[model samples]
Target: MSGELRIIPVTGLAEIEEGDDLAELVAAKLELENGDVLVLAQKIVSKSEGRVIALAGIEPSEEAREIAGDDEDPRRIEVILREAARVVRVRPPLVIAETTHGFICASAGVDASNAPEPEMLVLLPHDPDASARRIRDRIRELTGREVAVLVTDSFGRPWRQGTIDVALGASGLEVMRDLRGTRDPVGYELHSTMIAVADEIASAAELVMGKLDGVPAAVVRGLEVAGDGRALDLVIPEERDLFR
Candidate 1:
């Protein structure tokens, strides 16, 4: 049988004050097997990690007013700074960033949407890989089965305006599948042929997870991948960055 994509809505899971047995919660809801993968949105994890703040209480700094720069939304600027401290690089309206994850992104991935509590904001997890490991371990303890867990966050491409999901942290899955030295259809040797299988997997899960829906967790099965907690290895840096 082929692999499956099961997008399960996590209802009443909003006030996630602490990390739960995510893998087990997802597995039990989906009746997963040993090889299943759990794809979770970073928002819930951030909330659980106390990464959320009541934005209403946060005052916009003078720097934030300057950053806003005729945008006329001081709150947006403050939110951006709180999400990202110290701008790494900027180009007029757009500010490319060195996010807290060390991942470069626009707006530092500080999203304002889907905040369950009014006047509240969400931030990304401090260490997504560690969070992923914890969830994986908890799942293993609960079900006595080892499974892969992927911490996913929505990110915009450098030149692209739209957002797609990316794998921020992962375990029990290989981030890249190098096909170098492999033969092609014409018997030509392949070179520089590492597939970013991890990001692709994350994007696929996001297709079902959706941006506007309450369904934040997706159960992905049928894909066989080796996880080594090397999600960052897949991140293409600048000079190496196609957008730069």
Candidate 2:
């Protein structure tokens, strides 16, 4: 841990499109330094990966229509269904699904907000961890500085009311901090103490990049928590999941 930490919001990025060089775009706007953690909103990563879908092109299926009922757009439901690996729970106009990536989230990370145009939806990146690594590597190539990258998305907690940003993917940093077997300040051995460091950084960076702020990236300066870790390390295995 460092004595001081800084979160700097990156601004002035144009609407990202497929094949856009995100690392170049970001490096041009902000000067990155070694050991900095660059947290990027998932939408921009999706957009750059051509993950945007046009609702007009989607046709609602029978199951999708049944889920939509009358309050929601069947087209949107179809998109959600396509992205979901398993539908956990269904309430009209709301769905809790488990994505193919093993992430449990609402609407399977299919969001319509912040889309480039009307009737369009943004999807989660196909492989968020790979996306993070690509950006991190490109940033190093452009700026010659070693840095970490985290791809983040907003998710609602089952017991909580509002949404918070969480790391969907990570590269060049420790995604978790396990304190098991370590002695506490009171000489008590920790048995089950693990921290989702990537998620915490994502949430902190979100403070500067709001949902409607159009800011897609932020730099977290400080913290010597670099390591070779992936976001998949944070996923609870099905056999160990108590909620399932």
* Winning candidate number (TM-score): 2
Q: Tens-digit lDDT track for model 2 on 128-240?
A: 99999999999988889999999999999888899999999999999999899999799999999899999999999999999888899999998787998899788888999
Give the lowest summed-lDDT range of ten residues in model 2.
223-232
TM per prediction: 0.85, 0.98
lDDT for model 1: 0.73
Over 4 Å off in model 1, which ranges? 1-15, 19-21, 70-72, 85-94, 237-239, 242-244
Q: In candidate 1, what are the lDDT values of residues 15-86, reduced to their tens digit?
A: 356555556556666565677777888887777677776766678899777766785456656776766755
lDDT scores for all predictions?
A: 0.73, 0.94
Off by over 4 Å in 2: none
Candidate 2 has a TM-score of 0.98
